[model samples]
Target chain A: MIPLILYDIPSKLDGTYWSDNITKSRFVLGYKGLPFQVEWVELPDIAPRMKEIGARPNKLADGEEMYTLPVLSDPNTGALVTDSWEIAEYLEKTYPEKPIFSNKSKGLIYAFGNAVISLILPAAKFPIFRASQILNERSAEYYITTRQVMFKVKISEFSPEGPTRDEHWAIIERAFNTYKEWYDEEVGKWLMGDVISYADIFIGSILSWLKRVLHDNEWEKIVNWHDGKWGKLLADVEKECKKV
Target chain B: MIPLILYDIPSKLDGTYWSDNITKSRFVLGYKGLPFQVEWVELPDIAPRMKEIGARPNKLADGEEMYTLPVLSDPNTGALVTDSWEIAEYLEKTYPEKPIFSNKSKGLIYAFGNAVISLILPAAKFPIFRASQILNERSAEYYITTRQVMFKVKISEFSPEGPTRDEHWAIIERAFNTYKEWYDEEVGKWLMGDVISYADIFIGSILSWLKRVLHDNEWEKIVNWHDGKWGKLLADVEKECKKV
Candidate 1:
């Protein structure tokens, strides 16, 4: 049995999907048929252990940087893997019997799907959220240092000019729309085929987050898939995430 | 030999020293000591082929909504791997003899290095670039449409804000600074060890980019590494990139 440290927030019951990767990881654990132990470390308490393990937070700490959450560790191999994509790859490689990536074609689709969740959507949107939260603070140093990445957003007219709440959701909406268009043309239902790949798990988890933030019109198309099998699993994980 | 098409902008290379996954592919081809033919497709020209492959670009027609560059296809395997990290995985699995992801420890580090390049740094920097770029335009539709996954700056930022003349060289400074601190503490020299991993290749290629955007200060660091073995290879690449 591998010891998987979930280092999480205690708010899943509140229905907050704090990290998209955590939400996705839960679904992967369930779908992959692996019964593993999850150690819940509250985010506040994660500092020392994170440093000891060379893991950082995904969000900034008190003037410190953040690393991604939901790291998978095989105590047996002493392999501590962070980053959702890396974890997915690790699990796929380690658990070839059950098979996550399974085949090359499937793996490519999974990689593409992972890129959508891991790269494109977040790069385009997270800064808007950070900028909105720190807007009125006089100490731009705190703002800039704390979120050095969002500096690019400061130059955008929308940063100082437009209302940011609308900007954040707008980015999310655009991403979803782009995904919908791609989904329609490609494998449509699942990101790859009828069978669920790691991509489905990754995308479905984010879909949960979007649903939480989106208005009815924005979420209408995305919610349909939730009614299916994987959707139910994601809903359950959302329950776990809210507990954090 | 499987015919492979690499959609790349020979002029615009990315990632840091450790990101030599693409170069590693080329290196492996060289190491296999076999002559292999590779086709280069410029960034601007990939639109039609992208659409044909069912990927949608955000602003670029026929491009993926995400920054989908360095796509590799094994005509023999009919396997098209996107994302440099994925390409490394695909190649290692397909060519097990001279495995790129040599071992579990190496794989863990390689994956970590890839994430640093692909997610963490970009997440920090891209939003600022996006907000600034669209600041004047400031249309809700425009903001929303482009927000899905913003294209990462192929260059770097040294100025207070926005892309500057020294922007490309700035990328190298920021990228090297990131690893320098890590090198001082945990592992010395290259990301994993003396022998290069994907991280080394990623860093190497990006260094190649910085070398092209040469400044006296920039070339000071470049000259140190260039005086070595890789420096020679990098000089060769610099010439090729300039030729384009």
Candidate 2:
């Protein structure tokens, strides 16, 4: 068996967190029944190994660089994988016993699933989200202000009839509508099908993060559908952190 | 030899050019000098196959939303791959003779290469670069106005003792300034090394787009470097397109 090590860097102002996409990869690996050791090294302590591995410097100023997290290493293959989504792909490919992207037919579905989740990583990291705590007292006002700016940009990019940016609310609302319509058509526990594929895991991870960042009860309920299904699986894997 | 067919939707919108990253796969496939077909299908003509393939409508306006373009159908494997980068991976994996990501290293370099290219894509699509005829008369003014807004955002984000957003400037000015610090490093022809990796193709595509969009003398020099490297290769591939 190849020894797998996750070289984790500590969180900083740049929105690095143990629960971010990098750590979620460990969960995915665990879900696939893969054994890996976690070497949780804080940023200050990461210099030597990073240099040895020729890891690029973290670019984001407030926290660690966005590109640097969740570095995966397999000494046997002498493979070091970075980029959270790509790491998931490597794990799935390397360990085919329990497949993540089980079928190639559903590649786009899985890609979109992963893309949605990956989108959350940035959306969650938006400076506004970090300022959420400080702006909690003025949450409504801040939300209105920031959301207006975002909406203005969206409307400017796509006129009343142009292709809507899915990241925008109107588009996201439409996506939810589409998902709901599809769910109604086929009552499946997962997004793509009966079996959990990478899509389920990807959307599940983002839903998990959404549940964390969203404060409103209505929004919580909407995102919680995922909790009843894949959320439980993610939480179970997350419980492994305690054991670690 | 597997029969591969690529359906492309050409649009200036970044998402439309699905064939961008996978150009190398197409290049390698053709250079294997195998027989294949490349079909440039406009958005109007791509609905039926898209539904059959279960592509989620990415753009809301198109109710008939298809995933990113350049969907490849491999009759031999019965695989229909979507998402530009994944298509490249499939091509490399399935056709190992002339591998796109030749140095496996478990896809570490491939992921970073893709990421680097992604960063360059947005920079290329920054309106002024793409439709210079519309913006050229006002581009100088536009550049100053946009830079000021970006600088203000940077100041607000990193207030008081503002860490120089100069790196952002460095990336933008890369075409104009050849002697930037990163350039002095003699980091080979590409970011990774001598061998042409996906990063080279991805970065090369973005650089090409920038050259076409920017049309500045300085950027032309940058394109000249790319022309000597990736551009020549792409032109050779254009021959295969004629056959397709």
Candidate No. with top DockQ: 1
Chain B TM-score, candidate 2? 0.57
Candidate 1, position A173, lDDT? 53
TM-score of the A-chain for all models: 0.63, 0.59
Give the per-residue lDDT digits (tens) of candidate 1, residues B109-196. 3323544465335333333333333222333234334443454333234233445534543554455444443433223344433433
Candidate 2, which CAPRI tier? incorrect
| Reference-based lDDT, residue A134, model 2 | 29
User: Where is the poorest 10-residue window by lDDT in model 2 chain A?
Assistant: A155-164
Q: Per-model C-alpha lDDT, please?
A: 0.48, 0.48
Rate residue A53 of model 2 by lDDT.
81
- The superposed Cα distance between candidate 1 and the true structure at residue A67, in angstroms, equals 5.4
